[model samples]
Target: MTEPDDAVPLRRRTAHALDLMAFSLADVRDGLGPFLSIYLLVTHHWDQASIGFVMALGGIAGVIVQTPVGALVDKTTAKRALVIAGAVGVAVAALAMPLLPGFYTIAFLQAVTGIAGSIFSPALAAITLGIVGPRLFSRRVGRNESFRHAGTAWAAVVAGGLAYYFGPVVVFWLLAVMAALSVVATLRVPGDAIDDDVARGMDKATSGQHRGPSGFGVLLHNRRLMIFAVVVFAFHLANAAMLPLVGQKLALHNKEVGTALMSACIVAAQVVMVPVAYLVGAKTDSWGRKPIFLVGFAVLTVRAFLYPLSDNSYWLVGVQLLDGVGAGIFGALFPLVVQDVTHGTGRFNVSLGAITSAWGVGASLSNFVAGGIVVAAGYSVAFMSLGAIAALGFALYLIAMPETATGTDSGPGVFALPHRRQVQRDAVVGGELVEDLDGKV
Candidate 1:
């Protein structure tokens, strides 16, 4: 969409900003590996073990670089640049996969892609939090997830169609196109609209101003943040491998429609996720984070148990809708919680990265264990075991996790600062600022 010659209203401008963000998110998501298992299994004739090993490489790369990249996001003003680079790198890496020769080469390439792609999450979180601040973050993030899941849903449908006609390799081209659009959308997000201090998770309006700690240090010592990271890790460990395994299960029974079914599974989950994300955004402020997040874990647990009860593609997919419930809430609330916990520390991005690194560890391990278990005992046992793990995670969250809304005791102390109540913003007309208040433009 082109800009108007006349000054744009604030509402329209806000919508534009969100649309750009949605496009950017959609692009980055393209490179993430939902289809990799299908590609390895159908294209390369790889076994479950090999597919799991290869997929785990990306998770390993994230674990290695997530914290450092997050700290860099906190320190750098090039948040948008990080997102662009990650998007482009992922697209290029994905497109090059078919041309790559060996398993080791592909794994290494995936790892490289992981390194490049790790930049997007923390940077995007930083950008959004900076633009909206803590007060509006929950709702904005919900909208972000809605757009993001919508992108994922759209990508799955398009990729499924392309793969149905031209083979899975065609999916790569679709990603490349999406990546290009993502770059444009990213560029559309106004650079000047971002408040750097606020984005870094600090507000100068607060009294007793002081640099407390680096993001790494603060996140390390924060008990709730660390525990939350552990909870996320456990959740991802169980959640990540279930979809791929479902694809494998379908392939075993119905090789002809396997790819199509896998895509359908993704679309179904993402479609549900879009609405669930909006629901979380609308309710998190009023209802609080722990209950919402715990619901996600509980759904995952139930979904895991349900997977083994049916070999029917429709039944398997219906079970995956349960995933939408868990994933949607977690997606919107994860960074929001992080922002709340680290609100005033200027380590919001880095802290998010730290926790994501933990998530990476579990996600990577999920593939490995799921593969081994499927080979050893069978799919039913594998599903049940994963379900049990998810149940444990839910138990942990229910017992230990505290409510983390702004006024809650477990939330960050920054909101309690006196200056927070007095902060105000200046209005802008067109690209020109109408006023500036204490460096807020």
Candidate 2:
């Protein structure tokens, strides 16, 4: 009765499938991303204010659905199906954008895309956890992010080149292709490889207890998780608006070359993210999550201030390069931290959803506030304001957030679960189930 997850060959194949899935879903998850702003601004002649409102619509919708979607991932074993459905939803909503093009229609579609896109984060994390188990999760997450960034970099290059020749409309077709590939990748991951119990943070020790997921109150009472959520919210609040603002500024300066310039900005950051993600993944276990995460917040703070210092495209794009360090760390560490905090709660995905929803609130407001500021004052003021928020988040994280890595003095000792490695060792000795500290197997 060897589990599929324990089979080395199947696990290797599953890991490869996860890599392909991450790469393909990279483009599908965000829908049109900043391209939506560029398209609306340059093609449809929409003002920044209206474009921001439309963009915010999606984030707002995602905030509303993320928690519920996370709970759904926890409850269902159909993880692959959820990924497929989400990919289809994002692809269809984005591809339809060119045809509808109207304000309300685009807003409605963006909302749909947001709701669909929310499924990927929790589902993918759950699958990764279920397959690799907790001991290897940090490196696995790093590998996943690396592939995701590479996928984004590739998409930016292709989209930039095509849009340069064929106009922004080509991005829609590109999403369609990526979405199809994502579905293929999702199908390739053997569903049996996922351990339903492990996927939601249940371990063999507690499996026979038949205890259900801890109530949401457990998450609400976690002081550290709440603090982490606030920090992340601030990060997104400052981080989200900067890039789109740069894209808009570039568009304003040179409308004909806006898409290409935006692509350059994205490609630069994503290329940096690929390696940064791998580094964070490799070092997170040994170097710990806090110090690495602090670097991200610090880098973001610096990047924001630097953006307003220059209007030159190269300067702007170079400033964008710092995004790789900041966003790369956040991407790699976010899940690991949440997993650390909610280790035995059977609420990992749901808690992740809750925090991400908070992040969504910050991001949703970012576009609106930055847009209004740009309209009332200018891009420089908007960039500086976002930079200030990033600085505050950095200060808060440096002073208050605790280290969440296991075996650390400040780890989440409240959950009362055995160390992940100990649990694994206990499960495999002599091919017999050994009792854990609680005397349960």
Candidate 3:
């Protein structure tokens, strides 16, 4: 709906700012994947394999919890508040890291943070979709992804230096500060924003589409969704596991260089994400979302196979780009899928929580599994195996899933996600955002 009083929607720049601020917080913890395991090894004497297990738990929590959290987002009109609260939760959790008694303690704390992060993710994604509409959505999403990566790329230095000097706890302290800023930025989202997609979601739930779990049972009966969840679960297992290994591998060669490079790879990906997001996003929206995903996972398949093949510093940059493509494929679309599937804001948020919790589970599993794999199979075999796993998922998506974002996408998948209302807004088209408004932006 155009605000006749106002000439047009707010400049797309506003959306860019919000995504940058929000993602910065996540980069400190996640982007610094290189340091997390080392910290565990040094502080707790946990060993590589054990640290992997802890990280896997964190990933699982992120996935499982996000599912339910997505449900909550669908049920409410308070998308902005949910993101703000989640940011604060992340910050607080980061701050508490220094207090954990052991690896287990840190793992548990991470799980809590993962759960909280679930709410943060879907809400932020939903809000972005709501505000940006379809216009240049692919571009916007790409920009946001790049900014988040930029934070990680830059933070690589800080994470490595701190780990070298003061230990991992100092990095955690920095994370705390970033999280606080994330919360503050999240709150900066306008209170008056509205979208057609979100409006419809609230309308439907209030009407009577809610399932058995109050907010949790919406997808229990859907066979397709269950398969998607399982597949994603498998995919995240590798993702979560590989990250820590990256840190360990780099650290094994040169601790500081590894840490810095870990961040560097991500930063490199961030730098490239802009053009990729824009170009690929449009294609994703234009063609079937399946084909685009196929391409991304195909790249991942190569990445996994290639990573173990070389220890060369230059090649890691290439790996990050390819891996980033795989990451972007799912990262940008999954929340849109959750937004598409749920019936209400309450259910939406909860579903997100579930997804995040699943990530924690997968990551934790990967942590243990990857550490062992690295030790036995070596990084080459491990990375290759993980890529193969991603490829398997790509094949599955192609065979089973249909186009969910086509009729509804605003433009090509490329959309500019602006925080301002003068821009686009979320308008729930179908029973779900995954199927409905998850178009371009």
What lDDT, from 0 to 1, does candidate 3 have? 0.58
Worst 10 residues of 2 by lDDT: 409-418
Q: TM-score of each candidate?
A: 0.89, 0.90, 0.79
* Model 2 lDDT tens row, 311-366: 99989999999999999999999999998888766778888888888888899899
Alpha carbon lDDT of each predicted model: 0.76, 0.83, 0.58
Runs with alpha carbons beyond 4 Å of true place in candidate 3: 1-17, 28-32, 42-44, 99-101, 132-143, 157-170, 195-216, 339-358, 409-441
Per-residue lDDT tens digits of candidate 3, residues 149-262?
A: 556555665665665666566667777777776766666555454453543233322445434454336457555555557666677765656656665676667654554556
> Clashes in model 2: which pairs?
none
A best-first ranking of the candidates according to their lDDT comes to 2, 1, 3
Q: Which structure among the candidates has the greatest lDDT?
A: 2
lDDT of 3 at 70: 65
Error of 3 at 46 (Å): 2.8
The CA lDDT at 74 in model 3 is 63
